[model samples]
Structure formats: C-alpha cells, structure tokens
Target: MTKSTKPAAKKPAASKAAPKSSKAVAAPAPAEANKVAKTQIIDMVASATTLSKKQAAEAVSSMLDLIATALKDGKSVGLPGLGTLSVAATAERQGVRPGTSDKITIPAGKKVRFKVASTLKGTL
Candidate 1:
C-alpha cells in the first residue's frame, strides 16, 4: 500500500513591495536603419586603423569601461567632438502611482547627462 501527499499552499508577501521583475530595463531601438551598430563600428575601426579586429574590439571595450568607471566615481568625462558625460543630482519628489493614483515620495538619486560639443552640434 502507498500513501498520497498534497503540496502545501504558498503564502503571499506581507508587505506591498515592488516586483523583482519591475526593474527590467531595455535599451531603446534606433529610429533609423542607417544608424551604425557596435559590431559595425568595431569592423570600421579595424579596417581604418592598423589594429586587427580583435584588438580594436578590445580597445573599444576597455575605453567604454574606463568611461563608465569615471562616471561611477562622480567624475565628468569629456569626449572631444562628441560630448561631455556627467552625473547630476536629483532631489526627492512626490509621485503618484499609475493605477491606484496614490501619492508616493520618490527618493533622491543621480542621473547621467550629456552635453553636445559645439563642433558636433553644428554638423547636425
């Protein structure tokens, strides 16, 4: 003779917390097909410069990592003919929930901003 067992029901969270999946972020798609992608840029660099494709890719990756590290350290990065990347401080503010229309206080945070170079801005 065999005994049967049933699964126990799960309990809901006590606090009304945001979902783990809500933090998902997706990069915006390019508006034009003519826009160049990372791979294309790497290939272009390989062809234009003396570096091989692999070397060019590594250099690009390292450069990006350096820039990100700088921003994380609260330092501004200046890219000649491109733009400047800097972090801005934001104060706490009041916001309303979408569905319930309940007022909520948004916490202070930092955001990245870009300033276009005058030469680059003139071209576009």
Candidate 2:
C-alpha cells in the first residue's frame, strides 16, 4: 500500500540520465548534416564527369579499394592532387587509460600516416 514513495526514488535516477541521453541524441544531427557523405561525393562525381551515378560509384569504390590494397602491401601511395599515405611503425609506449585513469602499456603497432601535399594544403 506504500508504493508511492518507492517509485519516487527511481524517478531521480532516470531524470539524471535523461539529459545526458538527450544531449547525445541532439549533437549528431548537426554533425551529420555538415559532412559530405559518400553519396554526395558520388553525385558530385556523376555530374562533373557526365557519368551515370552507378558508373561514378563504381569508379570511386575501385579507387578506394586500390588505395586500401596498396596500404596493406606496405607501399606508400602518392596521389598527385591529394596526399601521400603510408603505414608507419609505432613504438611501444606507456599511456593513461581515459576512463579508468590507470597507467597502461600500449604495444607496438603499424598505423596509417598521411602527409597532405603542399598544393592541396595551399588550396585548403
């Protein structure tokens, strides 16, 4: 018969989490609108080259696949108008974990590195 007070305790916890969830939901909309997605890029390519959307998409996909294959083979790729991309070896290092704030050792790894061409940097 005393269920009223029992429910009140749970309401505060849910209310505390609601704003955080709402903020997370609200933040992504503007970011998504701002970025040009693959679809938009394909559309642009189609119009610029006078190619059908399907053809443009295939061309873009093939180019990306070629770049990925080159990187996997540890070859440095230099796109004349874009940049140079290469796989760089990383040394083992010590770092702090963000959530737990604990000291941790990060093992050695290979990471992709990009150096923007001077011409591209100037245009940007």
Candidate 3:
C-alpha cells in the first residue's frame, strides 16, 4: 500500500462585517435611479458611429418623430431586434375612489403597448 503525503487545503478567513451608523435613513433621490437621457444617447451614437454630434442628434430626433407619426396614424411599429410598439384600446371599468368605498367608472382609453421581441428577452 502507498502512503499519501499531500497537505490539506486551508480554509479561507471570514469577511469582517460593515459597521452600522445611527444616522437617519433617507429616501434615495430620483436621479440616483440609473436613467439615461436623450443627450447622452446622442453622444454615444455619435461616438460609436462616424456621424457628427449634430448629425447624430438629427438622426435620433428624426427616428423618434417617425415612430410618433406612425403611432398617431394607427400603425404598429416593429424594430426587428428591439420590439413592437402598438396602441391598445382598454375597455371601461369600475374603480374605487381613494380613501372612500365609493365606486367610480373609468372611461375607456387608448394606451401605447410595447411587446418585447423573444430574441431580446432571451438575451436578458
């Protein structure tokens, strides 16, 4: 029989806990919620492509205008890899008034609906 001579591995040390503070907890500011605005998008597009900042801004604005125009004309917009944007009609329904049990009728309305593409959803 052969004798084993390998040394056993050492266990890793535990991490130290963070110290607690007595300061009052404040709600996070809205800007802290990771939001990207249009200007940032324009800049990114310009940098990624060969287009100038002005050209990039114009392109982005034009694309948005086209989408809005199509939606207004009762047409569904489909971007191959992105998704589809369409207007949905919602039926009238009953809703309860806040702070009271009184029932109220909600009028039917049209709302924009986005259906994410399976390809995009799968990537996430």
Candidate 4:
C-alpha cells in the first residue's frame, strides 16, 4: 500500500468580517468638507448684490417655494444655466424584503428628475 503525504489547503478569510480595532476612524476628505450650505449661498448672494441678509434669505426661500409649487402642480421648473426639474411617472414593480426571504411589491410613484444644461456642464 502507498501512503499519500499532501498537506490540506487552508480556507480563505471571510470578506464580510471587518477588523475589530479601537483606533479612531478618519474624517471625510477635503472635497466633502468644501460643500456649500444654503445659508452660505444666501450670504454670498447678499454680499454680491444690493440686498441685506434678511432680503437674501427671503428671496432664496421664495425661489425654492416657487420651484416646489410648480413641481407639485405637475409642471417643469427651469433655471437658465442650471437645469430643469420635471416630474416623472413610474410603474409598479416588485422588490425583495431585506433580511428575510419573502418578496414584496413596490407601488407606482411619481419621481422628480433633473436634467443638467450644456452651459453648466461646460463650466464643470
């Protein structure tokens, strides 16, 4: 009788398992830090134009309200160089339930869509 002398192969580590370290996690990158908020935009507009902070805030708020109202009325809102916001109708579809083996159905819904203008794309 002949005897085989082969070592068993080792199993690979699980990809889902994360390292259990106590070190502090790193913060998001600088680009994310540079994101401008609504208040900052208002301040910029106030400084650039002949308007106070309160006036700038009111203007910004009114503009947003107008856009939202137009969209709610099933109309498209357009900003000259920015883009257009339109409402789109979606059909009903099927989806799976998370953490379980059961399936579910997702109802039809309306969604907002944005189309970037070529002028803005060139600036980017």
Q: Please report, as a residue range, the 10-residue window in candidate 2 with the lowest summed lDDT.
A: 1-10
Candidate whose lDDT is highest: 2
List lDDT for all candidates, in order: 0.84, 0.95, 0.83, 0.84
For model 4, how does the per-residue alpha-carbon lDDT over 5-33 read when each residue is reduced to its tens digit? 22222112332233322222334555567
Clashing pairs in 2: none
Q: Roughly what TM-score does model 1 have, to 2 decimal places?
A: 0.72
Candidate 2 per-residue lDDT, tens place, 44-98, comes to: 9999998999999999999989999999999999999889999999999999999
Candidate 4: regions farther than 4 A off: 1-32
| Local accuracy of candidate 3 as per-residue lDDT tens digits, 74-103 | 899999999999999999999999999899
Report how far residue 90 has shifted in candidate 3, in Å: 0.5
The digit string of per-residue lDDT tens for model 1 on 94-118 reads 9999999999999999999999999
Residue 102, candidate 4: Cα error in Å is: 1.6
| Highest-scoring model, TM-score | 4
- lDDT score of residue 54 within candidate 4: 98
Better of 1 and 3 by lDDT: 1
- Quote model 2's TM-score: 0.72
